[model samples]
Target: MQVSRTATKEDFNHLRIDDIKQPISESRFDALLEKLQINNLSEDEKDFFQSIVEDRMVTEEEFSTLTYEQTKKIKQFTSRSDLEGNYIADSSIGFEKLSMAPLLSAQNISDDEEYNEAIFNTFKKLNLSQDDGISMLNELGGYINQEEKIIFEDSLTDEQYDSGIRYKTYIGLDMKELVSKRLEELNQGLLETSDEDVKSDYKNMIYVYREIETQYNNIQDKNRVENEAQLEQYTRNTKPNPLYNADVVELYNNITHEYEEKEKKEFDELMDKLDISNLNNREKELFRTILEDKEISNIEMDKLSYEEMKKINQFIFKKDEKGEIIDDTLIRTNSRINALLRTTELTDDETFNQVLFNTVKSMNDIYEINNFLNPILNLISEKFTAFDEVNSINFITEDMNKVLDELIKTFDEHYQETEYDEIKEHYLSVINKYQDLKEQYNKTTIDS
Candidate 1:
């Protein structure tokens, strides 16, 4: 009879670890070990293959016991299987490790017991299945690798650093804590004055600290909240006017109250100067009616009867060659002036008078009026730029506020004299500019 011989360790010496595949059943694993002559193999080689088979068995047993919810969570982390149809994690830690099982069981790259313990605690707190937690840890490893590259290679460009920080934030990793700890280490090293190379390293750490500080501030600003009271006030007051469906009225209302007392006094003085002696009977009656009121509010002016308005119009206009009233110029000029007066809170009487005088004098035609008004409109745009810069910092200087006040007054004075469509367009533009600046100021930026 022929004697049967079993394969020895030397017979399978050519085999490598890469030759092993997954979905390895107990019988298949034993067959593989026997074929490779496990009895004759060295201690380290046998332990390595045996550990792999044990890990595979544990993974299969744990997967079988998973609830629906746990299985669903695990599916989110990994959707594929190995060549032999065994489940595999989709992260950096390969299928052989199957999640973070290897990190928990074997030694880590850095032998820091505390760091490894912290990671294990965090894994438990996440409340994920063993496989899911392992996948998460593997994903986290990618971010840590990126951070290590940045620290070790000193390749922290703006984009790279931003991406790394964002990933860490998404993973709930505390980069701030890491930075603070590193800073502490550097500070401690600075106390020792003996080694020149150590001093140089400390100096480099200082530079790195500056970059980290800037990035930290930027992140803080991006997530920072604004004052709730200020935000509420801005929202309530910035609402668009229902009548005009625009913010012009709302914005004008906001600043015009500051000039009400001064404007009322000016209006009263101007009315006193008008001579009723040169007026017709009807005009005189209307003039007396206006003067009767101690203060004519804007609402009262808007509520005036058509008869009262016509009488005032007649008194202000002149007669032409056709014996018809020439009140077009008067009407247009006053409309412009009144619109401006309604919105402005000008304290300078002389400047206010000059603006009115120039406006009335230039009213030969619409073209002449526009020519006189365009420069003032351009000035409003410039003032908007200045206001925007100040507002961005969440505070306005007295000088800038005053400049804006004067500019608004000038613009309001001339706005109504131009064609209604043209004036409305310019008014909307100014309002839109103000709104845009206000929005920019309200937004929370990383640098705030």
Candidate 2:
């Protein structure tokens, strides 16, 4: 793999969590990010930076290496999963850290200079720096209308200067930090500003702050989903097993079907003791984070693999009538016995690592310990709800009052009037349907 000039020398626009684990000739740029005091990222953030680096999410110097077809393949994965659902699961598991999607998504490293130039030119035309252009994505980051777009130098007052500084920081700063700072400013202004207009401005600022906060949350949701997907890929690459949950469950059932009650209980006691459903959410989260956790130099499944632990819990294998692997076709694996051993007790320590575990987890559909839907489901649900709210207008082009009306209508028809059991069941069904649709869509995702 010859490193092209652009891939070798391109500045780190922003390093993603995924990048740190990737493999690219951008150590200079990555080192520069740390040196510049640019992103005060957390441990998880550092993991994302390493992932993209190790994953080679850096720019491609030679367009010849990746054609239009390749670029399309990359973009085509955007809808493969739901992101918002990921954040909800994270929050449920006592994870208070900011989501990874917003920051990670911005670090997309397309090698096409024309694409960046075109995007930058459009932003320049819109009277903002190239940085500000991406930052002001109504959905990715929060936007403030400023009542009126005040031109620079329109006022040198403390309010305008502070707001302008915020505007600039809004474009360049980490989202979570940016929101925290703005809230601090709002609190400060409450004590300092006695004027009505100034007070109103502060009030409007709350709404602006929330929008960005929501977006940041949504971005995190996306990161959760993408992380799961990456884990799925890494898991597939690492694991040697061809079996999935259906196969495992079938084996479990068949083992019982043929064995007597006493023998069946032998494995049942172990499985029941190590109930697969009882694992903590964080333990499940480890599989996805394990993929991003680059601090560990190498990832193998067998040594400390979550799958190996579960697979060995039963410690029994079903045999065919002739004592051969049930599926002879899969026996063609590079190391047939080793592959089968992955789903049994014979897995070796040599294969223990994040990458290998991830592959096994993916094939097994090992979700984060929380039984909640995938993160991608959460993001899509939020957007869908927002869209529904926007669309359920009795009158088109109505303002905030119309939003209130829609909310009133929704609350009245669904939550407010129903009996406890009926409404609870209905709400659960709706949630289930939302999740089911998300799963179906994810499975059908077209890989370009």
Candidate 3:
């Protein structure tokens, strides 16, 4: 008879069971048990080892006890290099098996405490420390609670089927009542807490609860007819067609005709009240030309010729008490030029010239030229000439003409440089023509 021998650490490194070509003899089995140091083996362990030698099949229960070193030895014995070849020796699989075994077995442990104890012990066996084991158990409890919530939601009755509303009619718990209770609790908390942060947190919680409660109640009391109408709008099969309905088509045509007739009547009344008969021939023609359009835009007003604009300006701004045309455009332009003149530095001749040029070009009519531009030109001429204020400044003096001629020359020079080149050219022509006209008028008066 072969007696069993105790396994040495070096013996395990040389172990190779897969190389065995035949079933282990009784002596070899005894020797294998001795190498594994299983003298006090239980019946289950004995049967497990016996099956490995007799039938060459490893059981999960037998394999579960294997460490990484034991797995490596098994791989060597099985002519496999990968330790993972032993499925039951994998830590992940072992964790799953260990974790699930207690759960499956606890199907009979109806007591919650007992079941928890079983889970705790299973997790403990998984080599987790006490704190880690408790934390994992807490996480599992949270997951289970979430699953229970889902199940509860799915099991809601028709009366409690409002989505996102946490009210449970089946449990006779009204979310509004819960909100009221929470509000009372929050008020109490606010009174009890001296800490501002804690009070703020309680207030915020109350706000959230109140919002949820209000929304839930509002949804519960929603008008069924309106809801049904909205739902019908979303899901209705038939669409309205105004053209297909004779009454609707007739109503639309009648309304459109009525609107057109009303607009025409109003326009004709406005045209009838417009009396351009007193206007001069040129003004009448220009007014008629503008009347050709059913409407006049500000852009069209800006595009009017200088002569045409003059007639409109004279009619619009009739003579005031001082026998001067009260043209707001010229007044505003003069005010703006005066403001610029007041702000301008005397030595900044470039800026002064540019302002003068722009102001002259902005005049849209003869009225603006006389009232707005002439005054600005006079100011510029005065600025250029060395005149003693006590002496009256003659309008057609050599000094004024010299200043005017220099300004005209400057305008011509800036014509190509300015964006308003056409307007600048027009200004130069106006100044030259004005000087010529003034000289002729003065000579005529002298001759008479």
The top-ranked prediction according to TM-score is 1
Give a tens-digit lDDT track for model 1, residues 1-448: 1011112223334334454334454555455445323344455544433444443343544433433223322322222222232323211112333454523421121122223333444443344565444433432232132222222213223443232211111122234455567677667766743344336546654554555355445433433344454454334321222222123223333333433444455544443443323345555544544433222322223334333443343333344456555332233223433333322322223233233333333343435445444444355445432332112111222333344456556556556556788776776555444343234323422225
Candidate 2 per-residue lDDT, tens place, 322-345, comes to: 654322112111121233233332
Q: How high is the lDDT of residue 184 in model 3?
A: 87
Model number with the top lDDT:
3
Tens-place lDDT digits, model 3, residues 94-138:
122333332222211211222223333344245444333333333
Clash number for candidate 1 = 4
What's the lDDT for residue 156 in model 3? 43
Error of 3 at 282 (Å): 16
Poorest 10 consecutive residues of model 1 by lDDT?
A: 1-10
Query: Per lDDT, what order, best first?
Result: 3, 1, 2
lDDT of each: 0.37, 0.33, 0.39
Q: Provide the global lDDT of candidate 3 against the true structure.
A: 0.39
